[model samples]
Target chain A: MAMERHERFSLPKVWKPRNVGEAWSLKRSFGSDAEYVAGGTLLRTWWEGEVAERPAHLIDIRSLPLLAGIRIAEEGGTGIGACTTLAEIRRSCGLAAEYPALPEAVLQIGAYSIRNVGTIGGNVASGIGDALPALLVYDAELLWFDGSEERIAISEWLERPEDCRRDRGKLLMQVRLPDRANAVETPTGGGNAPFSVYRKVGRREAFTPSVATVAISAGRTEDGRLERVRIAAGGGAAVPHRLYAAESLLEGKTPDPDLLPLIHEAVEETFRPKGDVFAGEEYRKRTAANLVAAELWKLSAGRQGKE
Target chain B: MIDNRTELAPAQSRLTLRVNGAACEIAAPPSTRLLQVIREFIGLTGTKRSCEIGRCGACMVLVDGEPVNACLAMAYQVQGAEITTIEGIASGTELHPVQRAFLEEGGFQCGYCTPGMVLSVKALLDRSPDPSDEEVEEALSGNLCRCTGYGGIRRAVRRAIELGR
Candidate 1:
């Protein structure tokens, strides 16, 4: 099974810390040269051998027990450790049932192998990650430890990403989904669960960066009105965001065919998708609006089916 | 050859791993990529190195039974991991069933992508014995084959499933 060995060269130094506290201390000491790496899917691309800006110290945080595994809160929420791989999330049947959009978003990024090593924390930390929109719709929260432990809503973290960078000794601990168990699965009027849909239209059919992506969660009231609506978009290498205008358009209103056009218009008004070589601003704006409309239609369809 | 059990310091450390069922120890710098260690230090040329970026699946290997892009993994990440490469899939002078199926199905023309594709098929079959067409497509999506168009590879995946069962 052995093959003839080739010559080797000296690569940069890596530090392996056993726990979060030790890792944090290392981060504080190394400053810019030290970067914490879990899966290294995104970070490795930047700090290759002999690169001028290469990270001097690569901190392997995958082994730390503090940043591993998925834990379900006894009170009915889900907490995913920072090192939890996207493949783990994709294969999790429980998470899939509770938050379908999360698994759906994960499966569309890269492919099976990349997903295997790509951590959820890494994905969210990427800033323009595909999973952010879905997480926003699910009301996910980001848990991190700076000098002290702090937790913030994922929406807030997404708004100011640079502030959360680990370079400043602020390390991401885990992502928490609020306890949705007590929340009525079947609302008075329609839908079995909070119907959610995440759609990403990219340059290619699958396993490519999104040109436009949108995720939505909605439930109807006893009178067949839109009781609660949450809509978020932006995965196209553009700014990921929640569409408060679009969500406001549907909340507490009955599902009407005209609402589709209103939702699309609201999305266009809210988001200005940054254009790239693959797609221009107008095209991405149109696609984002279309995806948002499609999800609204899907949630409305689910309510109709229940009715 | 370095002793596999010789423990290095926790900070500046040597990598001790099982590569292709062999307990191997080698000097690994902190930032050394697994792809480099596999092809260079370990001398397993079966895992091709193309596009050092993680986007390309040319440098694919199985670490502890999970398929991951070797280009993206650090050498130390595989320190206690059971590493499997294209060379390790077969046992004692026999091609693994996936390789045989690829041969039967004409899964490749240029053969550059075959090693990664075959290992990916091995990982898929290890998990799902009877994978659906979409599942097969999803599993092999990371592996790009420009030569044979992928009709042959699709057939190879189906054939491998049958042969394994």
Candidate 2:
């Protein structure tokens, strides 16, 4: 763990802490010099991109008992250890069926091998991760350990990842997804079933950061009104945020194909996502809006198929 | 602007890595990439080193029966885990079915990305005997074959599935 020789570049000293207390103490002592790494996919890429420095001490917290595997809580909600890799999450059929948006977003993150090493926690911690919008729609809760423990909603943390990362020392422990298995208590049949979509439009088919990533989930009333509508958009350097205005507009409205244009307009107006040189700001907004509008129209189609 | 290839540093720990059904002892810092560990320490150069970043799947290997980008993982991190590389895939004289499929279908031209492509296909087939087109596409999406343009690789994957069946 004490290797400090720079042959080509400075490789960080890796510390394998056994427990949360040890991990915290090491972070406390090393301060900014130390970083808690799970998958290390994001950190490694950032280093290769020369955007960030390799920390002196990388506290490997992937093996910590508190942050290890996927668990089904007593209440039936899925509690995924922050250290769990995206690939591992994808393998869980139960979890995928429970929330397709999450697994769907996982598929769009990176290819299979990258997903194998990239942890969901690392994705969430990065904030700009493509998975953020999908997690947002699910109302994912992040459990963090900072001296003590605190549970914060993903929505709150996404607002200021840098500030949260700085203040909490990047100690994200678990992501708890609420049990939505029996959540559909609406008036009737398959029409009331929640429809969710996670779409990532990238420069290429894979690997690149998304041009505009969007996730939207909604349940419809028996009388045809949309309810519990959640809309989120993100990609590239843009901060992932909820489209509350678009959500409200879509809410209490029937899933008519004619409403697609208005919903699209509302999303385009609300999603103020940043864009890089490859894609302009307007393109990302429109792409996200189009994806959301198009995907939601499936509900209208689904209604027809049911009737 | 610092030169890193000047002087060597002291090796950190002697790790017993279980690679390809054999025990190989490697001594390096905790931060050494699995790519270096496999190539330099384990002496297996079959795993190509293109982009040191995890973007290119040239350095893919199976860790405990699951495919992962070797460049992204630290050697010490997977010390005890069972690591399988391209060199280990063949049964001595005979090549693995994935490798055979690549040859039969002309999966590669320059052959730089062949090892990784083969290993990725093997991983997929091992997990799923019958994978859908989407699954195959997703599994191979990380690997970049600049020469073959993936047409041959696609055929190779299909052929490999047939071979497995």
Candidate 3:
């Protein structure tokens, strides 16, 4: 690890753009020599060690109004600006109560101080961030801007993240989480919403990168059958991704003691986690499978009690 | 005014910020970490620098009344913001409640991690006046102590709550 003090790197000229268009235009003008920075928790760390190639121009996007608000749509969905701090998202009472996985995931990213400065947009664009799995399970959509604004599903972006960078000057505008009320509720008037759970097993209790993380948003149908089940897993050495194979197999299936084991096995097969210094590849895959089973089992048990 | 100039311009600029309760101005490169500015430029050494990376909270300081890793923050980013370093914690001869609590509860043996721990506790109590033991642990999660096994530290946090009352 490169451990030079902060001043070692010959500092780049910093540009504080006032708006999105201006920021984008600056990025275009600087071409490959300029990099957009929001919180700088991740980028600065990489830049210190020369992991992230140093740019001649550091475009500070912190001042841009285009990336600074968390607005709730009239329909109960949320439109979170890219620069909204992780601390804000972790403490959002409405988001916690409605979409539990988001806050749960955000809370596990780093320590309190890092959360205070780290932004959700920076997390998403980090490519292998802890929040990506939870966002995938929530079916979150991202707003992107090159010259014009466009919205794309997070799941699609996960498959080909490089596609978003085609423009070379693309900016992540915001993340949109659809209204949870739209998710089909229990048919028997149980008044319970879909169960969403996020579990992250790390090397230690807190402030450690996850060894394996799992997020599930699922619920039972009128006949006590599981449907609309979405599962995503990432963390540790693994590339954050949606578990499509497991999701397809579990859909419309009745929750039972046997079913969880099957889902666990399927996840083990689907989840291809890479190994790092913290854990081995086999350990990550096993932990991912175990978390998938345990979370599903708990969710299913809670549903049975409500029924 | 979109100045599409891509060339490398002047890296150093005038940065003005409120430190503790005083307004201050300094010229520095935009990449200068707030930790470096506070220690080297302002000459206040209370905030210790350990792991320059974000992993350790030894360089924690309050920016806008919230606990932040000074090492991770650039001087240019904190322009016009209120910053509180360890040196700013006490009010003259009268020690802050958290500081008094740490002394009374014997919160330090080595004293290297004390400043960061105290700042974390201050940030927590400012937000949640009476935090539970779990909340205390969560609040101080970033600040690590090699000695004391955190028993004394935990007591200090609880005592700080009472002292505040």
Candidate 4:
């Protein structure tokens, strides 16, 4: 006869707040006792009864006014509410036209249902795979709210992978992208100038965690020199990081056929990509370099041809 | 030896949600997934649960006019949100435009992925009134249907766009 174990489990207590004030109050009251559930896609998995430990209370922040919608910032950037779902971001024409790369990244996230429930805040909070890399390319800043105070900036909140493991209680509140950073004022005839592109190399076409993801945003001066370039890669290291050496190399130089090899070399030196089940380290490193080169080539060609 | 003597508490919780414009409450654990609540408790079997993780789009439903996977959403999260299931697609006797398109275009055969696919299209059309082919493909990419091969589904979305216009 098999021994029977009567395992009993209780779900965490839920508190749904209708407004931002209510959400803040709950956050203050619960302190570290609660975790905010926006889309609940990630939270559900974390507490799926498989985990031995889980939060005791869930504060549903979907209805919170502070964490909703997409608004244009005064500085000519986009302010995405933490609770705004990927589906909503993809559907907005204002955002689509203004920040094409954002919608492009949003369209490729999980599936229709996951996009519906997964909020930008949840994506940033998780700091996993393609989300951070894509935002990092736009020089995005994360806004965070602890129980007592709110702070901003990408550098301030981002954990160095080691730090993320040590602590908890920091909640990502919003992500802001400056409009002028990658905005193309004059259109090259072929279409609008390609300012940014997010590339993900995965096993399958859709709904696959990226083996390696690269995001690049750059601008070309009217005088034909590279004005600014931002590059970031993830899924191969402890944490996604800016390819500073690679960006520095491309800053003043025009991307020509000869420069492509140099760009590739610079990217390879900047990060030591590691292997996982999805791909080998060699493959990820090579592809990350190739992706950055390809994006640079495309942006340069768009500006040079002006077609 | 691991100690198993920790007394676990019994489950007690009631989740009230509006399903297809009707208020229904059920006694379930707080951790119960909305997918389970819909299919098991309310007995609305239209939503399919595949990959229980949020990767597969089989368990999609519209919550407050937005399409989301039921598998990843907790039942308690739907307290005040309006949920539309696959069963709610038809209006009394008339078929929804997407449903009609799917049938006419042979959008499904095994039909396991049909509910999610149709709901996704509904959400897309609700937002875009008229979307390009690329837009349609992007919208439906989340729902996986190995049966119809997606070519037919793509055609159905095109047809629905025409009909909707």
Candidate whose TM-score is highest = 3
Instruction: For residues B32-89, write the lDDT of model 1, one tens digit per residue.
Output: 7788788888889999887776666888899888788888887777778899999998
TM-score of each: 0.91, 0.92, 0.93, 0.83
Q: Could you tell me the lDDT of residue A278 within candidate 1?
A: 71
Going through the candidates in order, their DockQ values are: 0.42, 0.38, 0.55, 0.31
Clashing residue pairs in candidate 1 (N, C-alpha, C atoms within 3 angstroms): A14-B30, A189-A222
Candidate 1 vs candidate 2: which has greater DockQ?
1
Candidate 4 backbone collisions, by pair: A77-A179, A189-A307, A190-A307
Please give the distance, in angstroms, between residue A254's alpha carbon in candidate 3 and its true position after superposition: 3.9
Please list the C-alpha lDDT of all candidates, in the order they appear.
0.79, 0.82, 0.82, 0.73
Task: Give the candidate number with the greatest DockQ.
Answer: 3
| lDDT accuracy of residue B118 in candidate 2 | 89
Candidate 4 or 3, higher TM-score: 3
lDDT of 2 by residue, A77-146 (tens): 8899988999888887766667778888988888889888899988888778898899899888999887
Give per-residue CA lDDT, model 1, range A1-307, as digits (tens). 1111211333556777766777777777778877888888876655543232556677778988878988886666999999999999998887877788899899998889998988998888777789989999889998887757899998888788577455686678898987654344432224434566789998878778788888887665556676568888886667688999989998988667678998899898888588977789888888999888775676567667766
Taking chain A of model 1 alone, its TM-score versus the true chain A equals 0.89
**On residues A8-97, what C-alpha lDDT tens digit does candidate 4 reach at each position?**
254577766565545555656566666778886765555544432456767677766768899987877888999998879878887666
Q: Which stretches of model 2 miss by more than 4 angstroms?
A: A1-9, A166-168, A184-189, B1-12
lDDT tens digits by residue: candidate 3, A1-307:
1324335665678887667877888888888888888888988777766777668777888878868878886666888889999999988877776678888899988888999999998888877789988898888999988778988999888788576352377889899998876454333323345667789999899999889999988665667666777899999646688888889878888656678777888898888787986688878889999998887776667657766
TM-score of the B chain in model 1? 0.91
Cα RMSD (angstroms) for every candidate in the order listed: 5.1, 5.3, 3.0, 5.9
Residue A291: error of model 3 in Å? 0.6
